[model samples]
Target: MANFKKGVALVLAAATAFTFAPVANLAPVTASAAATQIADATDLNLVLGETKSIKIKDISAYSIQNYTVSSSNKNVAYVTTTTTTGAAVSADGATTGASLTFNYSQVGKTFDIYAAGNGTAVITLTANNTNGAVVTETFNVSVNDKIEHISVKKTSDNSELSTAKPLTIASTDIKATPAASIKTNVTATVANRAGTTLKAVSDDPTIVTVANGTGNTFDITPVKIGSTTVTVTDTDAQDKILASYTFAVTVARADETLKVTYDSNRDGKNEDYKADSTNGHSKQGNAVYLDDDKTSFQIVAESALGRKITYTSSNPNAVSVDNNGLVVVSDKVKQETTVQHISADISVKTEATKIGTTTVPAAEVVVPVHFVNKKYTTLSVADAEGNVIAQTVNSPVDLADTNKDSKIDASDDAVITLSTKDKTSVNLVVASNAGDNFVSGEVFAPATNGKIGTTKSDVVTYANGVLTVAKTDITTDTRAFLVLEAKPSTATYGANAKITLQILVTTKNANNVIDVAKTLDLNASTKTATIAAKATYGNILKYELVEADATQADGYKAVAGNSNTDLSVNASTGLVTYKSKNSGSQVVRITGTSNATAVAPKAAYVTVNYSVKKNASDLAVAAKSIILEEGKTAAIGATASTAITYVSSDESVATVAADGTVTAVKAGSAEITVKAASDDKFDEGVVTIPVVVSKKAENTVVPKPAKVTGVKVANVKGAKVKVSFKKVSKAAGY
Candidate 1:
């Protein structure tokens, strides 16, 4: 039945005995066989407002309507009856006093008794003959002032939490939470709680806090690392303790702890976390001997376990973290950037750790922190259009094709046509280190007789990072090795901060031609193509056809399907066209000679391959969306006649191997693109399917078993007792 529960139950002994759920075998009581006798019913103890049930074993012997149930104390308790024969339900529902009679009940059935008040109640079950009451059964019930019981359940899954004394809310049951604290929602069930509501408060709000919830539930949130007691009582009873609902709480900082580190380079590596030893002391990054004036940089917070990481600074006064973890230095810290650097501990959190059904307390570690001296953080320059090009202090950036005509050249007469004839010059912006004042600026270029950085150029000049080359300047090389010197003119910029920038300048109209096609893979439907060639002077060159052949001079042959008539070209215009005559591919060899003089590599050969394929019908990816748990695998499928390869848009979320086996790497959304490689029978095709990864689900709930229906008692002294229970739907067994 109920495995002998601690509460009340009915027992069968010759159709009359005391009953308790946990096998409390009280002595049997029977009525005289000649008179209308009472059947079994006992255990008359209850809480202030609780209900108990009992069954009638000898119900077959009498009609249910012949019995009238009543309580001697109308204000103490009441009785209600029901039948197993599916007869009209109890009319006792309408009568709330001490007694109730069934309007239509079958012979064999059960009835319920509810406690109405905290006092002694005498229940009388009288069986009537036609002449009036003939047999009477009296039960004395004791009603206690306490609630029947109390319980707590989870808000997420409705699963009951630990009901043991001093209940413990384990960390393994927590969900993902922020860095502040852990929050849990609890549901409590109690007896004698009809007109009252529960209110919960923490003894120390700095450690923990509780909010009143509807339906006797409470939300418990832990604030920090400390201990406190939560008292759940009626709102009016603020000082009065609730013996049944009070609990002790120990708080950690957050629900999900994590192992994290600082990555100064943002490369998902620990390049910054390593300590360097250098310059008479220790620790080295970039060499100042090479003019490494990089002073300010950004750092990224990373989780070592691939989970998302958060950031917090231990000493926010020196350097604080913004909402996205970018560093914001205070004025005091910025003033000391030259010799002092702020090295502070950063606290970081990761997503919750759950492997399959088991939850793990997040791992913690003191990650190695990177230390560096304060210097000028970065040096940036702007173009003629004021577009800033940011670079690290000592790195070099080439000025290729700056005029935007797709050529790089410098002529002997001056520079090239791009000499700054107008007032057009490339403007630059210098980021002075924090706490430093700027005065005046001048740029110097390399000269033949001067030192490397002390030289000056005859063609171009620079001041305050602005470099310009004029049409009247008589110089051939556009290369500008600029040294911005500290001059005495209290104008706009710099406090003797010597910064070096290597800018490779390119001018137009030089000696060589560029951009001759090595190979072409064009499948344009009309098959028209152009052999493009351009000179360093920023001009497209006209060409003459040198060779067009069907046979290979070298061992390389045309693709399997070609013939002599497949190619045609205009010798004057250098325009080519190909006519595909078969299902497979064909390759044609052609050589072009440019009219431009004095250029190297004159014999330029172009290889053009063409193919045609029929479209495959009914091509589609099998799944529109697939869901998988982390580390789980699934196969990719699509309808196609050609070979297929699967590609995941985000490999960190999911990975697809060459054989189309897709594996989930973490919990996120990704797309898998299925590509069908073309063959003679099918054209290339692609289909993308969305995939979602999730944590694995765990089973937790178990249903209660069947119920006790009847008990068969033997008349023989030594006979054993046989008990039967009602079969629960879908139950494997009792």
Candidate 2:
């Protein structure tokens, strides 16, 4: 194997030697090779803006240096660089602060600038000790703008110290120029102190005012020079006062002083006076003086000294104040307020007159009164004090215990006419303080001077305006008052009315009788009673009666249930017993009477205890039993209550009638039964009666033949009688 391997190696070495011998022969090149020998001829001398490729013949690797590109002069003057191997000018050329920078590597290279848009520039690149050589290049680039934009908003309420809210003033522009000056009203022109004319755009001065204080001076023409209180008011479009100033006018005065007296304590007096010399005070708010040249003084009103400010005036007048420098008005025609400011005097005057007027029409009122039972009731007329000054009384009356105190006496009159004038109409509602003693009615013409005006004849009629009174609801526990109201037309409403009426709610105790009471059991016999009695409220006496009695009592009497059984009652106490029969339930009708006749009939029912005895007769024998043959029949009968029933002991022997009768038909024992009546008394008891039957009988005898008859006899037809008899007849008995 070793010998074979050596031979093969020898053959491989010879083949390799042959393969390289031709390439070494073809290039014959050495270290003295030309540039064109290292790279392609056309690829040599590369342009400044182009890339080039280097190639070698036969040799696989080599190096190049000192490659260059010349510009402007051909003294081999080229873009400078360190001579090295395998370097070249990039497509963008070398970098400069003014242009782009070079970035080169063994295989790749590039150029860049901090920004884009570099102009064309000549540059060079030298290769290192590598096969590739140096090159030259030139390039240009365009740039794009890339600035960042940002925004921010204010944090506060979106306001700055330098900015101001727009201002508006009534009757003028905020420039303080008159509106009429904007048009044809030249005489009313507003001029500035600096010899400038204020321009305005408005036309009507009465409709608007303008502010011109931007320069602190303004002028108004066509006005009298003497001092006059000019009420200048400054307000925003919404009538809100942001700031206001008041000043005096002079021929040359630029600054004006506004004087004010303030009640610091609001005690109805001016405690201080302030002067504003730089600007006028705002009437809409606190007034102040701000002129640097003038001294601001304080003044106090006389009332500030804690002394009562008194004003003397005519009768029927009054005065007051709000304690805030507001003077209380009085009946005085003129009023004055005084104060001291800066060792000087100040006063304000105001005129006063009646606010309105009032008048009272002439009128009268008529009051109506009602009473009942002649039982002393009172009516009264009173002032606002509730005191009865005028009063009258109806005769004796009992108002009943309205308070339930068990007493009914009171002191007053039931009717009265009060005399008064010029009053307001009021309704003194007739309220029953004791029992139902009062009722409501209309009181007409209260404001008329005792002259009852038109009367309402229906509900309340007054012919020719004359007052007439009528009574309503008089019986039972009742009382009333006639409210008279006179409303004055002059007085203010709610204060114009006057109430004066008589409280005729007089009550007195009187005698009365309630009906009597009774009771009964239903088992007792039915019966009735007559009740008759009469009662009166006062002195009147009455009588009554009802008749025909089983029993009589002081207050009632028992009677038959007949036509006259109804009760007739006395005037005092009615006969409070029966007017009806005691039908288990009895009704005792009590007829009440007053003034000798029956008034009202009242009834009460009681029960009566009653019972009934049910007696029934025993079933009676109507007829005796009849004899019959065996084939015939006979019957026994009895009579009893319609409801009685009959039964037979043996139907084969005899049958009984429905009325307790029995019949015999066969020869046997029998019985008759009669039950108690079948009315509701079936539950009482049943009765039964027995019946008998006899049978009739007849006798017969027979004899028989023996041994002689022993002979067989098949047929024997009435031939002969065979007798096995010991016929021993004792002498002539046959």
> How many clashes in each candidate?
12, 122
Top candidate by TM-score = 1
**Cα-based RMSD of candidate 1:** 42.6
- The lowest-lDDT stretch of 10 consecutive residues in candidate 2 is 1-10
Question: What is candidate 1's lDDT per residue for 1-734, written digit by digit as tens?
Answer: 11111221122121111121211222222333224334455545554445555555443333323445566665666665543344433323443322223322322346667666667966655554323324556677776432111122222211132223222232223433332334677655554434444566777997666887777677876544456666655422344322235556655322222323343432223333322112211122321111113333344443322333455667777656664656555567555536453455544444343322334333332232222333333334444456544323322112111222112112211121123333335566655433224423444454443323455555556665566663344333254444432221222222233444443333322234446676544443436677665444334344432333323333244333223455555544556666655422333343333233322222345665554434443457767788999999987667676777788999999999987788999999999988888765456887888999998777777766655565455554566555554556866445
lDDT of 2: 0.28
Candidate 1 local distance difference test against the native: 0.46
Encode model 2's per-residue lDDT on 1-734: one tens digit a residue.
10111110111111100011111112222342222221121211111122222221223233333222222221211232221343433222242111122211222222212121212322222222233322222222221111111111111221121124321222321111121222111112122222323222212233223344343333233221122111222333555443222322221111112233443222223433322322222122222221111222233233110112222212213223232333222323122222111111123211111111211111111111111111122333443446444332211111121222112122332233211111112222232212222322344322123222333222222222123333222232222233332221221111111223332211222223334344432211222233322333322332333232322322345444322432223324332333343222333343333322222222333222222323344456544444554444444455555566667767878776664445567687766666655443223345555555666555654434332333333444687654443444233332
Q: What is the lDDT for 23 in model 2? A: 15
Candidate achieving the largest lDDT: 1
TM-score of 1: 0.24
